[model samples]
Structures are given as structure tokens and as C-alpha cells.
Target: MALTSIIAIYALFWVMSAFVLLPFGIKTHDEAGLPKVPGQADSAPANFRPGRVLIRATIIAVVLTTLWVLNYTYGWIGVDAINIFEKPEHLKR
Candidate 1:
């Protein structure tokens, strides 16, 4: 029981870190009204790429969570908790 609780806690942390920690590492350009640099044309829109960062971070988080779930559940694919749903047989009932 303790092991299952620990696994749940760890998985929670992993998902939360993916959504929080990873995005925070990315630098978003919020500099509106700032002066344009030399060689920078005023007509050109700022090349802020928050979408790319968000997509990449989401991908990474999904991959990490998938691995964690697979490892914990011994090959289970898309579910969250491991011990509660250990075997395919358990789900049949």
C-alpha cells in the first residue's frame, strides 16, 4: 500500500513538473512597446515563439509521463495509477 502511495505521489510530481517546471525554463518575449534594435525593421512583427516552446514542452511532458506510467505499471500504456490496475485480468471484472 505504501509503495502504491509513493508511486502515485511521484507520478503527480512528474506531471506537475512537466506542466510547470519545463514551461518556466522557456523564455517568452513579452517586450511590447520596447524600442527596436538596429537592423530591425519596424514593419516586421516581433518573432516571439511561445507556441513552439509550449508544444515542445508538452511533448516532453507526455513522453516522460508515458515512460513513468509504463515503467510503474509494467507495460501499461495510457492509464495513470499502476498498482491498482496491475493486470488486464483485474480490469475484466
Candidate 2:
């Protein structure tokens, strides 16, 4: 059940990203300026930089992924609050 839920969440991410994010121009690369490669003409717009929307979306996705991982393994809010690495010697059975 847990594994299935995780898979579903990831599936939802792709679905949401395609239908939701792509519409608003949340592109992976620069829209106006193409990235410079070796021995290439600078044909793209020089004034353009990475979009703020993409950056914010990426950050939000990472944060949510971390939270999901924490919730799955420890059933907690965050990973830092749960000391899963600390051994409880009494449970050595």
C-alpha cells in the first residue's frame, strides 16, 4: 500500500507538471536565450535569463519530495525531528 501510494504521487507530479506547469511557460531551459555551446554563434537573446517561475517550482517540488520521504519511512513531519539512525538497543531481538 505504501509503495503504491509513493508511485501514485510521482505519477501525479508528471501529470501536474505537463498539464499545469507547461501552460504557464515553466520551461526547463531559457526561453529567449539559448545556452552557449563550444564554437557556437550567440544568436539568442542576450538579455534573457532563467525564469523565476521554474526556480520556484523546482524548490517547491524538492521540499515536497523530502517531506514525502520523511512521512513514508518514519511517519513524521520532517526527517530531522526523527532520529531513525540512533539505535534503540532494547529492540535488538
Candidate 3:
């Protein structure tokens, strides 16, 4: 794949990874035994850590993208492997 395509795929994976990692390692004020400020939502996180989130997202994205690249290189999984709608020759008769 082209460099631009790889970068784009990496960015997509990064964003997805961030969302997947968002709910992990989070603590609500109630969970942390901290008093919530007035108007604070009960489910709001006690703290936001962009740096940690970014680091985790980057790690996940790197692993995912590396696997993707390896699959592309080795053809480990192909379209035929996942074809659900295609009828077998024996069944089609």
C-alpha cells in the first residue's frame, strides 16, 4: 500500500482505538469517593487524561495496523475466506 494509504488507515485505527479505550481505567466521582460539583453528571469521569489516552490509543493503533500490514503482506485472510452469500457448487445444483 501507498504511504498515504497507510497513514490514513493508521489515523482511522487511532481514532477507533481511542474510542474503544475511553471507557477503560475511568473512574466516576462516585466511584472515586469524590464529591461531585453541582450540575455534574453522575456518570462523568473523575478525571480526564488525554496523555494516557493518547499513549494507549497509539499503542493499540500500532498493533492493529501492524497486523493489518502483515495480513496484507501475507494474504492470511482473503475475500473468499469470508464469503457468506456465495453458494457452494453442490448446493447450487
Candidate 4:
């Protein structure tokens, strides 16, 4: 539960949030009835608003980081919950 750890976690969440939310509010040139530049990529967005993406990513990262911090604090979901390769204690015998 160190400050650096929290900051790192937040940064990781922020990047993930940004990437996952990137395509959500976007539209291709064709989708938006906009003309494309010469040789532009087919998937380019007509409206690429970095500011909107930034805001949404920030909010998602905050919520996710908070939940992660809470989980770290309370041990609500432990490593064993998702460790599929190893046999649990009761089954080890």
C-alpha cells in the first residue's frame, strides 16, 4: 500500500482505460459522411477528440484504481481466487 504503488497502478489503469474507450465515441469518415484525405486509413475516426477521451479515461481510471486500492486494503479478492494452475489448500492434500 505505498504511494508509488498506487500511482503506478493508476497509470496502468489510465492507459488501459484510454485504449478500451478509444473506439467507443468514434466514427469512421464514411460513417460520419465526411470526406477522407488521400490514402487515409479506412478506420480513421471522423471525430478524434483527445480531450473527451482523456476525461473518460481519467474517470474510468479513478474508479478502477479506487476499487483496486480497496481490494488491496480489504483483501476482498485474493490471489487464490484466480490462480488456476495451483491446487488450493484444501485440495492440496
Candidate 5:
């Protein structure tokens, strides 16, 4: 793939990774035994850390992007491997 294509793919993976890890390792004010402000939402995080989330998301995105690049280069998994609309060749008459 071209350099730009790889960069786009990595960016997509990074955003997805960040969203997937958003809810993990989070603690609400109630859970952390911290009193919430009058206007604060009940689900607001008490110790949300963007740095940690970014670091974790970066690591996950790197791993996923590496596998995706390898797969694109090596054809380890192809379109046919995940085609679920039709029966597989082996299962078809």
C-alpha cells in the first residue's frame, strides 16, 4: 500500500482503539468515593486520564495496524475468508 493509505488506516485504527478503551479503567465519582458536584452527571469519571488513555490507545492501534498491514501484504486473510452472505466453498454442493 502507499504511505498515505497506511497512514489513513493507522488513523482509523487509533480512533477506534481510543473509543474501545474509553470505558475501561474508568471510575465514577460514586465508585471512587468522591462527592459529585450538584450539576455533575452521575456517570462522570473521577480520575479520567487522557494521557493514559492515549498511551494505551496508541499501543493497541500500533499492534492492530501492524497486523492489518501484514495481512494486506501477505494476504493471510482475504475477502473470501470473511464472506458470510454466501455459503463457503467447502460447505456448498
Candidate 6:
């Protein structure tokens, strides 16, 4: 794959990882024994750490992207393997 394609794919994976990891490790004010400020939403996290979240998301994305790249390079699973409707020539006999 091209360099740009790899970068684009990685970026997509990073964004997806961020969203998937957002709710994890979160603590609402009530859960953390912190008093909520007036007008604060009930679901809002008491301690939001952007840096930590970003780091975790990056790690997750890297692992996923590495596996994806390896699969692409080695063809561990190919298009034919996923084509459920089509039978291989040998199997069609």
C-alpha cells in the first residue's frame, strides 16, 4: 500500500480507537466522591485526562494497525476466503 494510504488508514483507526476507549477509565463526580459543579451533567467525568486518553488510544490504534498491516502483507485472510456466496473451482465439482 502507498504511504498516504497507510497514514489515512492509521488516522481512521486512531479516531475509532479514541471513541471506543473514551468511556473506559472514566469516573463521574458521584462515583469519585467529588461534588459536581452547578449545571454539570450527571454523566460528565470528574477527572478528564486528555493526555492519558490520547496515549491509550494511540497504543490501541498502533496494535490494531500493525495487525492490519501484517494481514495485508501476508494475506493471512484473502478476499476469496470471505466470499461466502462463491464456491472454489475444486469445490464446485
Strongest candidate by TM-score: 5
Estimate, for each residue in 1-59, the C-alpha lDDT of model 3 and write its tens digit: 88898899999999999999999989999989999999989999997798999999999
Rank by lDDT, descending?
Answer: 4, 5, 3, 6, 1, 2
> What's model 1's overall lDDT?
0.57
Per-model TM-score, in order, reads: 0.34, 0.33, 0.88, 0.84, 0.91, 0.86
The lDDT values for all models are 0.57, 0.57, 0.93, 0.95, 0.94, 0.90
lDDT of 6 at 31: 98
Please give the range of 10 consecutive residues that has the lowest summed lDDT in model 4.
79-88
lDDT by residue (tens digit), candidate 1, 1-93? 266765575567556654664434432233455566677655544554566655665666667656766666775544544446466665678
Model 4 residue 16 CA deviation (Å) reads: 0.8
- What TM-score does prediction 5 earn? 0.91
When summed lDDT is taken over every stretch of 10 residues in candidate 1, the lowest stretch is 22-31
Q: Arrange candidates by TM-score, descending.
A: 5, 3, 6, 4, 1, 2
Worst 10 residues of 5 by lDDT: 84-93
Clashing pairs in 5: none
Model 6 lDDT, residue 54, Cα: 98
| Overall local distance difference test of candidate 6 | 0.90
For 1-93, candidate 5 gives per-residue lDDT tens digits of: 999998999999999999999999899999999999999999999999999999999999999999999999999999988988998778888
Candidate 2 lDDT over residue span 1-93, tens digit each: 377776677556645544455445333224555576666554444443346445655665666666777777777665565669876668876
Question: Cα lDDT for residue 51, model 6?
Answer: 93
Judge candidate 5 against the unseen true structure and give its global Cα lDDT, from 0 to 1. Answer: 0.94
TM-score of model 2 (CA atoms): 0.33
Model 1 TM-score relative to the real fold: 0.34
Model 6 over residues 1-93: C-alpha lDDT tens digits? 788878888899999999988888889999999998999899999888989989998998889888888899999999888998988789998
Clash-forming residue pairs, model 2: none
